[model samples]
Target: MRFWMVFAWLSSALLLAVAQETVLTDDALHKPITVWQRLASLAEVLDDIRKQTGVPLRCQDALREMKLAVYVQNRPAREILEQVASLFGLRWRRDDDGSYVLYLPDETRRALERAQRDDRAATERALREMLRIAREWLRLPPEARAEAMAPFAQTREYPANMPYSAYLMEEAAAQRQMTQEQRVKALVADYLSGYSPQGEPSKPKRDAFFSEEDTQGSLLHCLSEAGDAIVNRLLEGHTLGFSTRPTPDALPLPPRVLLPFWMRHAQLSDESVLQFDAASGQFTEVQPLPNPDWGGYWVRLSAWGNSLEYMVVALRVYELDGKTQKFLNKVDYQLHLPHQEYLAETETWRQWEAWATPMEDWTARLKERTPLERPKPTVNNERPLLAADALEWLAWHTGYPVISDASRYVPAWYRDSLDSPRALLTLLSNDLWLRFDPNGYLLARHKRFWTLNQFEIPERIVRPLEAKWLAWQWLSLDDYATLAAAITDEQARGFTRVRRRGSIQFWTAFDNDPLYYELPALRFWASLSAAQRQRALAGEWIPESALTLPQRKLFRAALYREFPPPEQLLRDLPDDYEVGLYVPSVFRSEGVPESRSEALKQSPDAPAFRVLQQNPVSELSVLKYKDELGRRTYTLHEVKTQVSREGVDWKKVFQEAGYEGEPAEAILKTVLDTILQFALPPRMFEQYILNQSRYADFGRHAAP
Candidate 1:
């Protein structure tokens, strides 16, 4: 019987499962299991109603399993089913038997949707309120409102119920001591009039909205104004009013508001700005004041043992006319250094290294005392004198050559000029005589070389004694004195006793003449018979018949062509002899000589009638002679004399050649030939002569 019962139960479970599947219809199968599936299957109807409408309803899991009648609310079943499907995770689908299948859960789906919707609405309302508050704040004047409201503007959120105006008023009151009504008026005035340090204007006709006078109604206002005046006076005193500090705080009782205003302007909010009274150098009583347009102002005060050390005061005031806001900042600083303290500090660092020591001590001392009262300027007496080794070290460090001229020397006048023993020591230490004594003495005596002009002294000496004498010159004097002081024998003559040569000037003459000669014999030799020329070329056959005086001279001239005389020999030779030899043709007159009276008459200075009558010798010719074999070689010289050419005149030629056109005509050519003779090489001499012709042609063309 137990076996039968177990089998029967399993069969029942399987049947019920099949019935559930068969109940779904073909239409339900065609449709998807979606939010609207509940309306297509009655079994899911009540579950769907609860979910979709947020209403609790009865559900029958056993009836659903058995495929019995499914109950639902009286509301439109389709609507209820749709709502249930949407609210809860339920759906419908068609089964193989053409029956609809409904899936449902226990919870009310519609109630959850309602709660979510309400939450979303409330959030949205809060966001709207926040946005409204921000808009209101933005509409408020920037000068009247605080910067705290800026974050709200960025997020655009506000409290849901509070009025925007009321919020703004609260913010203003917190930042500034002002009532609600007063805040509105002030912000409105600030918005319309822009930043106005003075109170808002009563009448709107004129653009002027406010003045400082209008803001004087409040106690803070009076205090701030009074503080401003006092700080201004302090700044003036520190800078322009007087160099000295006042005896006491002369202004009226410190303005309560002004103290905060000054502190704010100075940026003394940090604790670092203030210090203990015993600290002496510490600042105290730091505070900051609010500025309408530009943040706040800061100020601070510091004391130095028994006296106020320093005070910084400032205020941010808006200038309406200039349309600018500026911090009128001022500082009062006083340094009080007791004499004993200063002396102690000075002694502590008296021997300190020059490079590492602070300049504060030196600068302070300079400011505190007059020049007369201060210690005289002194070179560090303890500094070791620069010996040769020291100097070598310095030279190595500086990378410059130390020359002999930088030797030690002292002048008698230097000894007389010393004002004190310390000064004298400095003079002696720097004196080349003491510093470079042995070396300077040895160089002066043995080398006979002074460092005066050749060697430059190091800057140490050059900067001081550079005006009158050189380093070596001074060195010589110092060494002489030092040597004299050390010498045991009074009779021993010092280096100074040695007479020195004074500077002297001398004159000399320079000779720069070139030798010149003709080569007529060489030319004649070329003209000889080839057999005769060959015989001449051969040493065996010689011209036994001695040459005539003129021929011998010509031969000598030919020898000169091969080998010219030295310039000294040429300069010693008679000028006339040189001219007659190589330059004979240059001196020959190209034209026949005319009487001076006739020449003058034909000159340009002559009367026009006399010029017309005179033939004005336009052409000239000359005969040139040279010594040859027992005969004179003659050559005809022709010169085409230009009378007044169309474009050029004799005056133009003289001017173009940079000549004054002196009467001594041959002298000019002689000088020019002399210069060219030595300046040009033998190969270039002919080219130079040819170039002269080219120059003449250029001059002729250019003449006007």
Candidate 2:
């Protein structure tokens, strides 16, 4: 009220001032300045302007203190002031009393308003998505809603009818304090104006909408006009209000992620995603993003206590697409830590463990009873555990190396839910023939490994619906000899070798891959004498048809190749050095990968890029690609490295981050929430089908 009163008083004074303007005729503002200062403070120059023009300047002390350089050789006082104000990031308006008032620029004042508008638009888009979900929920039977909305809400209850207009009406009555007639007008006005935000597909000036504006009795006209005075956007003539008709009837469903959404504390809604990955610090992706044209989402979260300033999890959401996971959008969210209350974790990176819900109430009774005196793990509250994780937890307690892809290698434990860890271990040893190698690595000859395939480990999750004991077991020569200790070395070696178990082996075998000069091409080059080299360059070896014109020229110019190698290129280097050679696996650049096999996906050794040897860890080698006839060829460079590892000041890191020790799981969840994949319950959605027309819209792969 006080603000309005002050505004009205100023407005009245402006009217009275205008009445006096006719006689006063403030012509000094239009007058030119006399001097040009190279560097002048606003306070000094503006005062000079006031003195010369006899026009008083009204501005804040901060604005007055702003200094700028100007070359204003006899310019109007008003023009000078305008240029000065612009340079200082300020704006000026003529006051009612014929004085100039300096204020902030337009965007600076409306920054918060623009952010709010964006947030509102994102929320509206997500709400439209929910309304569609509600329609689908209504279509589903009562029994199905629970399952369908399990990713979204805790409850199955929802309005039977459309809720958009009802919400608008509620906003009108409760917030707007609109009368019944105005409320009806709002709905009626929406119907007449078609739903297009840009107001494209203009109505054909019909009787139902004779003109663009319903100017005869407009309620929002004054409001929009008032807003226009502040920001020019509200008065846009092209505002196609939303459609009164319902959202589209048919909808494709979202992909079911491999996340464990069923949790004790965290709840993932259909619109809101909360992912958790504590195992691998690196982010993992879940495939098949939603189809296009579905609106994206924006979320605002409340504080999880006084939040710890942490890292931002950048989520790169792509189209649930096989066509290169077409880059769609990105969202970043802070990780939350709610460890005080019984914290929950996202089953996003769940292990395929068997009935492995931690027996939180468990004591060291098993350790007390058994001979294996391994470390006793901290007992936690009992909750559901993924099968793969259960096996790993038991392994952690017993100090066992986790079997690679244990979920696929040992498929039985997923179904066989044992109550105790001993029962699980007992099941493994007695039924699956579990045994460790001399070095403590799990042996590969177990029944579990043989169940899938005898020649190779099957590259798939071989989940048999029913347990089939020794289903694929067969007697191999090794297996047969294992049952008979009397079997001689000759019998064990496929019955070919004589009984020479005590004989000393005279063979020395070594791999030549790391030996730089041992390449076959180099050997061929060395085998050639000078005359042979001359003949070879003259096309004696490698027919002219096989050699391109450029290749022949290169061979002639390069003297057919150097035999026994040239002098050292690194002769300038110091002699005191540590060097050796190690070769890592070379992988094809997947270029976002077409599709990876299950074996390759689960194999740790087959990373897209990895250093097999750690001591000489360096990416200093260059991969040189050569064009050849019907084959890819490369010359590899090898180097060995030895470097001391640097120690990190983790205490300083935690201190700088405002943490006493390790932060809560909520913090991790906050980071994961940024990623939208919510696959849980060990259920996966339909995989993305690679088709001929995958990138039809992207113009990469043309339509089939």
Number of the top TM-score candidate: 2
Question: How would you encode candidate 1's per-residue C-alpha lDDT over 35-128 as one tens digit per residue?
Answer: 2220122334345544554433343442241111111212243333333332223454444553334555343234334433443333333223
Candidate 2 worst ten-residue window by lDDT: 669-678
- Candidate 1 residues lying further than 4 Å off, grouped into runs, are 1-88, 91-108, 135-140, 144-146, 152-704
In terms of lDDT, model 2 sits at 0.28
State model 1's lDDT.
0.26
Evaluate all candidate structures by whole-model CA lDDT and list the values in order.
Answer: 0.26, 0.28
lDDT of 2 at 279: 47
The true-versus-predicted C-alpha distance at residue 547 of model 2, in Å, is 80
| Count of steric clashes across candidates, in order | 52, 25
Clashes of 1: 52
For model 2 the TM-score comes to: 0.17
